[model samples]
Target: MKKIFICFALCLLAAFFKPASAQFSTNENIKDQPKWGLAGQKYVEYYYLPDIDTYYYVPGKQFIYQSGGYWTFSSRLSKANRSYDLRGGNKVVINEPGAYRYFAEHKSKYGSSSSNVAVQKSQTDKNIKRQDSEKTSG
Candidate 1:
């Protein structure tokens, strides 16, 4: 009876799993990386500002398979956030694209010395606007 139960549990687990072939793919050698974003959680799909480099904690999901250059797994995708790991780190299991960089200057400028992740500011970044306003109005 115990053996039968174990077999049944194993079969259930197998049934729940989605084969990697039908799911996602990995571009481990992807030449480009994804752009970076603010501290907010989400994939920053914008023009990458190369001047200021940053290493954003890429959000990821509980992916288990691969299909067509994307990770595939039988899990509901997180809407607002790109999926995050259990420990709340980058969920992008694969660094297919840069997606993020380390902004040393921004860190120093903002007086943020967190060694965990870096962030960049665009030439037209909001902070730049604020500075411009301060310059003109002041």
Candidate 2:
């Protein structure tokens, strides 16, 4: 009976910690994102390329660009935009799945701001803060 009770307690403990472990992993994923993606974002559905006026669907790994007045989705950029470097362009992470549908209205909205640089600065600040806290605590 004591062994069964101990086993039950261990099972309860594992169940309680499972969700916390998953949450921690999700946070790590967000912190390790690429430059083309938002610095601290997970599950980015799309990346809006303001310079070339194109959208990169993250989940599908496809590029959404306007071709001949119609939206064309492809795994690679069209021949015309092949020269446009993906890394050099400013990208906005859109978490919504159908974010491209409203691109026409919001395209100019993000164009006016230099948010890419701002996000990088914010991420740096977070790292500094975390280091300072750890130093003081430890």
Residue 127 C-alpha lDDT in model 2 = 39
C-alpha-based local distance difference test score of model 1: 0.32
Q: Which stretches of model 1 miss by more than 4 angstroms?
A: 1-40, 45-102, 110-123, 127-138
CA RMSD (A), model 2: 10.4
**Candidate 1 residue-wise lDDT, 1-138, digit = tens:** 999999999999999998668456552322232322223323232221222221232333222332464534324323423443223222212122333232233334432322223223344345322111111110
lDDT per residue, candidate 2, 38-86, as tens digits? Answer: 4445445677777778887766778898899989999888888898766
What TM-score fits each model? 0.18, 0.57
The lDDT of each candidate is: 0.32, 0.62
What is the TM-score of candidate 2?
0.57
Cand. 2 Cα-lDDT = 0.62
Which pairs of residues have clashing backbones in candidate 2?
none
Q: What does each candidate score in C-alpha RMSD? A: 18.1, 10.4
